[model samples]
Target chain A: MPEMVNLKINDISVSVEAGSTILDAAKKANIKIPTLCHHEDLCIAGNCRVCVVEQKGVNALKASCATPAEENMEIFTNTNKVREARKTIIGLLLSEHNNDCLHCYKNGNCELQSMAKDYLVDSDKYISILKNYEIDRSSPSIIKDDSKCIRCQRCVRTCAELQDVNALAVSGKGSEMKISTFMEKPMDYVVCTNCGQCVTHCPTGALVEKNYIDEVWDVLNDPSKHVVVQTAPAVRVGLGEAVGLDAGKSYTGKMVTALKMLGFDAVFDTNFSADLTILEEGTELLTRLKDKIENKKDVALPQFTSCSPGWIKYIEHEFPDILDYLSTCKSPQQMLGPLAKTYYAKSMGIDPKDMVVVSIMPCTAKKFEANRPEMYSSGYKDVDYVITTREFGRMIQQAGIDFETLKDSECDSILGKHTGAGVIFGATGGVMEAALRTAYEIITGREVPFSNLEVTPVRGLEGVKEATIKIEGCKAEWKFLENVELKVAVAHGLSNARPLAAQVQNGESPYHFIEIMACPGGCIAGGGQPMPVNNNIRKKRTEAIYNEDESLQLRKSHENPEVKRIYEDFLEKPLGHKSHELLHTTYTKRKKY
Target chain B: MTEINIVKDAVKKHGRKRESLMPVLQEIVKQENYLSEERLMEIAKEFDLSSAEVYGVATFYSFLPVKPMGENVIKVCQTIVCDMKGKEAVLDAIKDKLNIVPGQTSADGKFSLMAVNCIGQCSNAPAMLVNDKPYINLTYENVVKIIDEYQS
Candidate 1:
């Protein structure tokens, strides 16, 4: 066992790991030290001086987050000088801050606002120097209001650390500092994946999702238009947190009821399209494998999953050369968009133009994904409006619907019906596991070798996970792969995707398929999921997704009757002409920045 | 050699490490006057640095401007020590001479004035740097003389 260091925090003795920070020791001693810049998931940014504490013998107050607790150290978490320093820092931060918390989206949820309240820093104690900055509403996914920024560097770190898409940077010196894109380009013009990872980590209203709730309200209010809403699998698990429900609690029924109360004509599930994606993506992978095995053709192995719009955009910008490696399947959000407009509309005897398909995603990137010009293969624009899970929550609240008290309701038939495989698509390594279930069953005509089909190797929150499956006892068609070791890798966060993509590009990759989710822990911990998101919360959300997958009756995509029926009635086969035209889409190579 | 090639050569000279970032950016700024967005992005890739990391340092240093600069750059120290020695008068003279405020460049591209931090010329209280060349013990007359030299 590691030698523990003993320290006294607030007159209470504490023993912690040798290198534990003073904040950690204080936490152990149950002495609450409020911190603004400290996040459980991010590296220690000691920039925010709110957590400064008085040390008995030290000359100056120490930042508890960055300072390590030494043996026999006497620390005072609550002291007059410490309180003064914190209040002064908060007051100074407020003085320079563009304060319109009354109308701010992060009014109640803001860390700075809460800290000011905690320290009773209501009155401005310093000379107020307000700076005006232009609000960037260029990207469909997210907005950057620099006027409200605190220069905490959370967004900067999130963009760089979590996503490896350094779309955000602190520009200007000292007092004139601001976070901006390279060359100070508009959000859409830069290589920003539009993943709201930055926004989720932002302590203020500086970065936020581009709101379409009002637009959604307008479409919902339109009597002539049929506004149908589809919720992504991740939304079911993550929506709970927004509506005061505990994390890891699946709220499918109540959420559907809430959406109905919000005046959605037909509440659908993106899960159906997720199941459809597995079918198409799986077939594409098998076909590619067969071509390489038989024709000896140079096909890109390690077919990367394209369910994540942020990951898609990242590959487009960073690894443009390996664009072909990406599976041509549109995200479940995009797929449901066209299907709602055409297939669902035609069956419901409504005009496709009159039907507005709205996707409630756990991603900001979905907004950008839905607006892609290539998604308009259904004659009319496929998906009309895209709203995040948070936006959906706001709509529910705006509609005066009691989310907690609402009775559980089921989604409308056809597009709403899905398998457990579809539900698990929200979690990392889920797509790979789901694809394996379908592929192994199709090829071997047997259940996936794993008990309960958990595929334990691929599951969890590791940045990069590799699993090898033995293709044993395959059918005659796939005889070439009999007893062949099929390797696969799963990566979440674009930072993780970078190395995987590079390996594939450089021909150093040793896998048959790769699954990449742009957000940290997949859609469950998506940029648009909830506020105050971290690793523990992500784990809870992941558990909820896994729980949801396990609770569902049908766990395999091929077993999804609606998906089967859609194939039999409309698309006919995976990778078919109609499927290619409607379900699958192409990618554009962006400038490598 | 082409401008892009020259930049690439400078990148090679500096080496593709984080420490080399400052030198690479400085050289680019020296050659290109200011770092372009596209060029910054290119340098980001060449150095394996994030655009944010590159922009952070590039923007933090006033000398390495992210925007276009005037042909002749003027930096006046505005620290307390410099202020006590009539740096403000020299600043006023430069502003009046150039017909611009600090942080603004003259329309003619002759002079760009900036009130910057101290250059450690405490012995000679007021100090300024003209195009990276330091000028010490400045008076309003000397400041005007320096601005006149740049006007030519």
Candidate 2:
């Protein structure tokens, strides 16, 4: 869109777009600059100071990431001064860091490990100042170990700018500087939505999703266990990247094959449960509207969708006073957990107690959520284990499974059947779109006009999105108006949801429905999807979700024959006693400190 | 339900809501001079959360009082900018005069010594907050006299 600027990096001339940083220009010139805090997706923090380069006329070495490239600028990437500064920065970071990489969860794949090797840092140079800081393992999704933190501000930037959730911030300064929540509270008590965007962006072992890989492996190895794995909608779009596949490549077949190799007895799909959620949630909305009009009964206004575990947790913690506004339906992942243990196990003639249900998700919060005591709705542990997409990839590598060569396979029957509406649940605004498709049909009692069901209002990467849908001519005259405008809002990241929640809390806002996802861009950019994600990758993954949605024959949730069959055979009806037992869940407020 | 009723009911009846936690903790600290383990456990159970989670959150933040505070709370800013402007000496003077450690409360409960990372008053250089009130441009000699004024 703009003119290109030519720059010489290590005596090689490279032309990059105007406003490109020296690091980007160097990348174009094939000159390597080691960075810890600078993520392509996250805004440049330049706090790591590891990418310093010697400029021709500058008095001091300039950080390549923060410094903009000028025309005909000469930069030396490997000068002694540049090397010394980088080494010193790495040395300082190492001195403060807990070098217990052997036992650390990040182990061999840690960026800090690779950076140290590339810079040839002397680990023992500086005297270590061991601050007796406590570890925060209070949250279900993440574990915060400040001892290993380099104060690079990657997590802060990811939380604030990228995710639009200011869950983490730099508190104090200098040697005492540490990242903390409001008043240094545990993440669970703060405004954090449990989105693992911070974990994906964290360069070191300081932040990590609590690992459930060991638990899954243990369950799989046990002779008495019948382990079943269900993959979420977003996992198929990004799991390919973890194994060196191109970003946004759909690896549903390879993912299933890999899971089968991982010793899963049956590979299921969470998409089926996603379709189920639309039925229950959509039916609930219609029932509320009907009752409100016919019986003059007051139902909960502004029924917030409870599809994202991170968003659910955020609302539970930050806006507990408005708990009634949240939809009672458990997330599709959570719903699948109970269904797999009880319904599927019974139908297959297997004992529910002997079944271990593992969910492969694009979320870190789902791991934390599965462990919540209330999640066991099937008289046994519904979901026994949870693994992020990255962890699943690591397991594939660990088990020596060739992900690329894996054969295409179909998901298990019964719980695997999904409509296009369910597949698009991977991206933000997808839930609203899917719900509207069903809602329109339910209201009209006929096929929705124009098979190309596109609700363009709720699409895009904006933190908050809104739309007003006018339902035309309905047969249910008592409750339905000719043009009943349904006001809806969708917010992805928790930071954006905070103000919206605050409005609902303060009674200043009114809406018919709301959809909130914890991670920015919804599950497509989940905390567990992939590492080193940029805006481009997120966009590509989101496009893949919509593309999958468009190519499907059954675009509406209500039209899925399997979903209707499940309802008739097992669930009985949407929000029925059986449905409530299987799909609905309650939340509890957490202590601030 | 009315909004006021909801807020009042939540504040008075539901003790577990996170929004109410800050206010409840403030009241508890105000009454007991510090947060008690029993109170924290009660708060945790009320919220359907673990005591460890509550304690971890409590200890992580700087505002929450874990131990009994003195009649007067003396917090000195020891962040980078303050350190550069001689906040350390000011802190040392207060500790020396009171004969108490940074986290200790005096025997008479007249003063509690603590060092905060920053008070966010960069223009004042070395600053101290006494019981939530800011006192800026603090010197070693000035700190002792300031405490003397609070003694009465």
Q: How many residue pairs clash (N, CA or C atoms closer than 3 angstroms) in each of the candidate models, in the order given? A: 0, 0
lDDT (Cα, 0-100) at B47 in candidate 2: 56
CAPRI class of candidate 2: incorrect
Model 1 / residue B27 / CA error / Å: 2.4
In candidate 1 chain A, what residue range of length 10 has the lowest lDDT sum?
Answer: A122-131
Cα lDDT tens digits, model 1, A112-190, are: 8888888898574687787767889999999999888888888888888888888888887778888888767799998
Kindly report which residue stretches of model 1 are placed more than 4 angstroms away from their true locations once superposed. none
The reply for model 2, stretches above 4 Å from the true place, is A1-32, A40-44, A67-78, A130-134, A160-167, A181-191, A293-296, A445-451, A473-481, A506-510, A590-593, B1-152
Candidate 2 chain B: minimum summed lDDT over ten consecutive residues — where?
Answer: B1-10
lDDT of 2 by residue, A1-593 (tens): 68999989988989999999999999987778999888887777888888999988987999999999999899999988988898898888888888888998888768888888887887568988767779899887789999878888888887777555456766654566688775566876665667898988888888988777788899999989999999999999998888878886777777888888889999889988899999999988878777766677977778889988888776776677899888889999999989888888989999999999999999998987888888989999889888899889889989999889889888887788788899989988999989988887777765544447877788889889998877777866524545778888999877778778888888777678899888878899899987767678888898888888887888888877878888888989999999999899998885332
lDDT of 2 at B29: 62
DockQ per model, Cα: 0.70, 0.08
Top-scoring candidate (lDDT): 1
Clashes of 1: 0
Q: What value does the lDDT take at residue A321 in candidate 1?
A: 94
Model 2, residue A328: C-alpha shift (Å)? 1.6
